[model samples]
Target: MSSTTETVVIGAGAAGLMAGIWAARAGQKVVVLESTAQAGKKILISGGGRCNLLPSVADISDFYSGSSDNAIKRLFRTWPLEQVQMFFEYEVDVPLQLEGETGKLFPQAQKSIVVRDALQNELLNLGGEIRFNHKVTDVKKVGGDFVLACGDNVISAKKLIMATGGKSVPNTGSDGFGYEIARRLGHSNLPNYPALVPLATNESLLTDLRGISLRVEWRAEKNGKTLELGNNDLLFTHHGFSGPAILDASHWIVRDKADLIINFTQVSSEEWRQRFIDEPAKTAHAVLSDIVPARLAKALLEKANVKHDDRVGNLPAEKRKAFIDVICNYKLAISGNRGLAVAEVTGGGIPLDEVNLSTLESKKTSGLYLCGEILDVIGRIGGYNFYWAFVSARLAGESTK
Candidate 1:
């Protein structure tokens, strides 16, 4: 059926839903279109189904962009995370619980449905409508309104919000169709890559370490300079590293390949050396076990070619340093990433510089707006991405007034 509205939002994820709700509340007739059979599929599987709704902290520095750094900062200043949280609490009527010290938030039920249902209900309550399975085949702006072709029916709206997200997790419907629509409308898009994804490696020990997770640090150096430093839990998988720290490393690895140093101990070399010296009678594995996991301790000792019973104090000074070196700086060669299928979000899209920060309206097109990961600002692993979706969409929706 062909329909016309004041605003037609594409992709009923976090941003589109928010835009529809706010626009409807602002007394504009709105309709949100979704490609998937259901809304918020990505939300359902995020954070392993609990769906981390907001980060513990979403500072300006947490985000990165190539074209619109200033625009991102400006957007955050106007629509801060605190304001979004307040909106959820008061307007949406969903009480959110902060999960950890870092300020990650989730619903009290800890299920993604709570967050999704709240958004759907709020949009409906405000007289906004959602059209599921309405995948757009093409978009054309004739005169003053956006014309979207979805199968046999045509939809027209005075304004449009592209919130289809990025290329990450295509199975959940973030397949990058929005980027094409925005690009055709004269918006410049940077090269997109998998972000918050795992890095692939050729390390043979990964097979042995399969399923083992340890808190560690990944240090990458580029052209004799420190390029990235990631500190979080690293999970060893049959293929490569998968955990928060390694997932964080994917961002750096994608920019430029760098030499990696895995600090299994997450401790100082001098301090760890002292432990070995103080316990000369103990086996190297036993001494190392005090700092890292026992299985990793054995692996590190084996990689260093140090005997398990080697006396730390009696060993030659050079040999002792070599053992300590392995403990402090275990190196790994990064090949690539596991690809977008397993990535949490994508990096790069329509740069924020092409949109007005205060309203999230397109600078190139009169009525087109952009939000969510479909924008160039890709944040670190946390609730930061979700926070951006809510804040940017709010600005776009309120701009309709």
Candidate 2:
């Protein structure tokens, strides 16, 4: 069906929905076009279905990891953490509870659908109409309005906002389509890569260690220099490694050809070895299984060909040092990432300089705005990405009026 509105929002994901709601509330006719059968597909699967809303301590600098530091700083100053929290709290009654070390925030009930449905309901309450299965094939400016051709219908709006997200999770409809649209509108896009995704290891030993998760520290190293270190939950998948710790480390790994070193002991090899040597009778032969999980300890020892039954007194200094070295710095060569289909977010999008930090509007194209993962701003695992989407969309909506 042909339709017209003051503002047409592309992609009914987090950013698009928020934009539609804000614009509609401002008395501007707004319509949201979603390519998928349902809205907020990514939000449904985020945080394992808990919907991480925003971090507890929303430090703007900590959230963004890009070259456009000035732009990111300016954007956050306009819509800081406190403002973001108020936006969600007023829209939805869901109370946010801060999770683990990373200030990640989740609903008190830990249900993602609650967050998604709440936002969708708010949009409806604001008189924002949503069109599902309305895949925009092309967008062009005709006269003074934006024309979006989708299937057999043509949608026209005075302003266009692209919140189509990035290449991450193609099944959820973020297939890098928005990048092409932005490029066509004279915006330079950074090379997009999968971020917050699992890493594939070249080590075949990972096969036997599948399903083993431990609280440990992982560091990415390039040219024998430590690049990044993340200490949290680390999972040993059949292919390689995953979980929060590994996912955070993947960002640094992408920048260089790095070797990931897992420190199961969470202490320096020298210190651990010295402790073991000083208390041989009490700790050395105490079975590594006693300190760590039995399965993990056994697997590590087996991989190193160190006999588990060997007593401390019977073991030589060299063997003890080798065992300590392996536990402290277990090296795994990262072959590559899991790709866009499996990534939680894309690392790059339209360059930040191409858009105004204050309004999130296109500098080259008047009345055109961009938000969410569609922009080059991407955050680490947590609610940072969601915050970026909400803040940028809010600013765009408020500025357009």
Candidate 3:
């Protein structure tokens, strides 16, 4: 193996592999160092093995949530959606299809291995070398170039790109090692936290409602005001609620006092209460199983002290109103999130302001680039994060070329 190359890409993930492919295609000698026995472990598991390649949405603003809007804006503008799609379609030989309402792109065959194989094949075709089981322990700047020490071998390169992902999914080989490397290279890290994880609740109701799922609208409330509203599949677990809607809201709810109010009713409590009182005989004994799952309905009724056999016609007005209140707005106190183990992505990393947006090179370190989840840029669910990985790595590779 050549000890030195024009460019060295670390991590061999989506971003690192893409960078190696692009830089090598541009005629720069490139080498990729991966700690694991094989690369693309995360990619293999993403989208439940289908691999959401990219989002079909053209607008980039909908993806990110950090304070650095300008940085994100510039990064997307450099490598926009259309260009990202074309790269996979033509260069990588992976045809993509839009899966759902959010425009998430998956392989036409819905196999993640296809995407990983395609990218790796393209990189190899362009003469890129990937060193597997090479875990980089330390990175140092010696004079003008970067020297990486991995398992007794010191590899030097003209430029070093850190595409090591964040602390999420440590078993996949991302354990925030890149953050230590960045700090050693004079980059300041923002406080890292788990994002896109499940929320845990201290409430007793959730214990009985575990395994129950409902289509409901949930809103995050703080200091007597609603912070955000989301509508999607909500699930009850032994700890608390999870699913797309609950997980998405966990970011904002992390700092709160573990208290969140959920609206389980299809309509407002006041409206439902009025209707129930007006037609108690017709609705009071109505089984909630039709509106919600049988188990969930039983739990809700039990919570409201309403017997399953009690006729709506026999129910008192006050009791009917109380049932409506519990059904419409059931308050549950969230204890915490599930942490990095179950998180799909992390929230913070290398701050955007510390890196040059056009190049993805650290403002503090010359000849060093940071990409992927290692940087602070994180996206919501769907294929936004994958897009960011591709675009950011493309900019870094092109700049180094």
Candidate 4:
């Protein structure tokens, strides 16, 4: 006979594991099920295995939501980043450290295993049952109880929590089946896209510039407006462009389908024009090589149809203007970004309106809670996603009264 528990949490990733630990420690009969034999596969690989736990400062503005209004702002108010960090430090008993000025926080031990083991141990010591290799294939609500089918056995629970994450890396077990399960339970979905993923451009053009890394700003220009994505090192690959600038800016560029302009130097066009006018004897490439990678500097001069050895004063007015335009505003057309298979986190999922942010419970169905990447809120590159997973799960588990 299948017995019923107070809460049945599916997927042993960050959210599910955290929820079970929280619920069990609160004296509830909680059971967490994982399709994979091991839990926290993504966690094991995150932050190069050290696991970037959270950001030193996290805010509602750090995320992009598929919702109409900025409901994510309200969600953070319910469970802020500071409270979540304190939960890990004091309750989970994990020491933490801040990563320089980036505001990224990581486990002091510098191993993702520390995070995985801490949550697992806390859940087990508090009398929670976690079943591995138990894939929840189906769910049905019978009366006030929820019945979940896993292979030959069926488990019933008064409350159900789905934390199966979104499709990012398939090998880590996020296959996007979680979204299908939500749809089966009557939740609508938004289009999912690969965010925080390296972008691919014309290989022929970038062949000579592979492996070159430089710090620069990437601007997504669309219909006369320029959108500035923050500065970071831009890596030129044989296939396309990458590094911090490309990945962080990929979201906006992908959405706008805009042309990307790489600003090799921070100086404005007017400033560079005056500087070039002041230096009549300096060659175009000679001045550019000082600010940008030598190869890139040469390429920009060659692309502008100006000779590398040509003096700035000898160049024609139209030619100089064109050179200034191309150098100051080096552009590229975004082909496409890597798919969810290599993406860090999926952009869209079940709409935010489908669930109550305060409890992370589904509004369409009673006793059904959804947390983590299952929702529409996707965070920036850093530790924001994991922060959401832990907080939403912790709150969902606590609300299973």
Candidate 5:
């Protein structure tokens, strides 16, 4: 059946559902279209199914974007974090608690379905409707309204919000279809790659280190300049490295082909050398184990060609210096990444400049708006991406008023 509405939001994930709810609250007839048989499939699996709903705190600097930083800053300022939190607490009635160490906010219910149901119910309560199993195959803008073609019926809207997300985690229904729609509707999209993904390398040492996890400082560098640096837990996988630190820096590796380096001890070369001098009688393995994991320490010693029982002071000068360097500045040649299938988010899409920062309305297409991962902004893991989805869609929905 062909139907027309004042606003039609494509893709009923976080952004689309949000846009529909707000638009309906604004007294506009709103319909949200979803390709999947269900809504918020990605939400169901995020944060290991607990659904990190929002960050306890968010700053503009926490997000990466190729467009003007000032523009992104303005968009964030439009919807403050406290206001969004209150909306969940009061409107959706989902009490949130903070994960102290990570600063992530989760529903007190501790289930992602709680958050999804809150959104779906809120939209329905506001008289908004969601059409599941309605995949938008094509979109066209004629004269004053946007026309969307689904399989057997057409949907027409005076205004359109595209929130189909990015190419990451395709099984959840975000398959980069929104980018194709954006391009067809007169917008130029940037090259997109998987972000927040694990890095893989064939380094033989990693095989022995699998299942080991430790805190590390990882740095990504390109062209002799550092691109991104983060300190978090790193996990040794059978393939390579997977953890908060490596996933956070994967963007630079995939985008600019940056070199990956890690500081296992978070200690400077001089500091390590001083430790060796201070403990002359100790075996190198014993001294290293104080800071590094035992398995990793043994592996590093092996890689440096230093005997595990070698006394720190008795070692030759070259051998002593070599081990110190390895501890402080170990570099890995990243063969590849786990790709979009397992990636937490995507790196690139329609640049922010293509839309009005105030409303996320397409600058080229008069009535089209964009939000969510389909945009160029790639927030670091934690709840920052969800924050962007909620805030940006709120702005787009309220703009309809």
Candidate 6:
């Protein structure tokens, strides 16, 4: 015999939990099935465990989606950030504190476990049952009911919310299984890729400059067109670049096979050239060091084949031009990304158009809905991803109720 429920939400991650909570609140018998023994595994590791739960601001322009921008706006507008904050503070009993510097909102306790536990407790208190270790292997819609197969046991629900997340961070239990279920249930998935992951570079200069961090103007260029210009702090990792700037711009790099051009000095080539000419007698290293780190100044000179103590006025015309270009428009040889294993979020999933804008119900299958990273919405470094999860899941759960 199969156990049945009013609502069955697959994967008890951020989206899954939120959906379960809302569904239970609406008097539905909800069972949130999690593959792993623990809930919110990804949440446990987010923001280094502090858990950046929401972004300070969630502009539709801040998110990337294959769906229309207006569609994205409507979804976000459904549950604004203010209401989300209130829900965490009052309903979940977890006060949120915003980090002024990053515009990321964390629990006042500054703990990821706190946020996870609070949500789980709220759901349980509201009569929602979370069956951990009950990994639903397959789902099928028969008439108006959805039948979910979790190994030998079968659980059926009038409404099924697919919050299994995307392929990124597979260890967190989202192994792209949600897409498979969606495909089998009659939905098209977009090309999936790792988003918010660090870019890999084999540039010897960048390798040597590991640990050197600075504010850079990072640009993604493909063919002759420039895609995005992200201005943020960029950190040089042992392998490549990993920071807010790189991670935020990574989707563009991965999607378009784009080239990365960084303005290390945050100045244009003409401005840097003019500065060099103005300080004709000053050594290039001396003038550049004031603007950039001393180590980078020395490395740039070496890369340009100019002596560290070479005066700007004494440098050959070609050498001076080369040095300016190196500093102002440095191109990184991006070999590849760190892949989905270490990615913060997955880039692609089911197209948003496939789901109803207001309710997030599947257009192809009745009583089916999709939310979270399972949809092709990629948010930037802050808490925009979580913002999407909370908002979308809330709508799905409420709509089912």
Q: What are the per-residue Cα lDDT tens digits for candidate 5 across 138-224?
A: 999987988899999988999899999999999899999889999999988889999999989888887679999999887898887
Supply the global lDDT for candidate 2.
Answer: 0.81
Worst 10 residues of 3 by lDDT: 58-67
> What is the Å distance of residue 187 in model 4 from its true position?
0.2
Model 1 TM-score, all chains together:
0.94
Per-model lDDT: 0.82, 0.81, 0.82, 0.84, 0.89, 0.89
Instruction: Kindly state the number of residue pairs that clash in model 6.
Output: 0
lDDT of 1 by residue, 1-401 (tens): 23668888999998888888878877788889999998899888887898888886776667877855667778887777777888877877778898664467887788899889899999988888899999987889999989999999898988888898999999988888888888888898888888888887786765577788988877877777887777888888878788888776677777666676788888878886777667777777767877777777777888888888887777778888888888777777567788889889888788777888878899999898888889888777788888888888888888887
Q: What is the C-alpha RMSD of each candidate to the true structure, in Å?
A: 2.0, 2.5, 2.6, 2.0, 1.4, 1.5
Candidate 4: tens digits of C-alpha lDDT, residues 43-134: 99998899998988986656787775457776677678888888889988888999896778999999999999989988888888899989
Quote model 2's TM-score. 0.92
Model 5 alpha-carbon drift over 4 Å, by segment: 1-3
Alpha-carbon shift of residue 34 in model 4 (angstroms): 0.7
Q: What clash pairs does model 6 have?
A: none
**Which regions of candidate 1 are displaced past 4 Å?**
1-3, 276-282
- Which portions of model 6 show Cα errors greater than 4 Å? 1-3
TM-score of structure candidate 5? 0.97
For model 2, residues 190-260, the per-residue Cα lDDT tens digits are 88888888988777767567888888888888888987777888888977889988887786776555777
Candidate 3 lDDT: 0.82
lDDT of 3 by residue, 47-120 (tens): 88999888778454455445467667878898878988998888778998987765789999899999999988
Candidate 1 lDDT score at position 115:
87
Worst 10 residues of 2 by lDDT: 282-291
| TM-score of every model versus the real structure | 0.94, 0.92, 0.91, 0.94, 0.97, 0.97
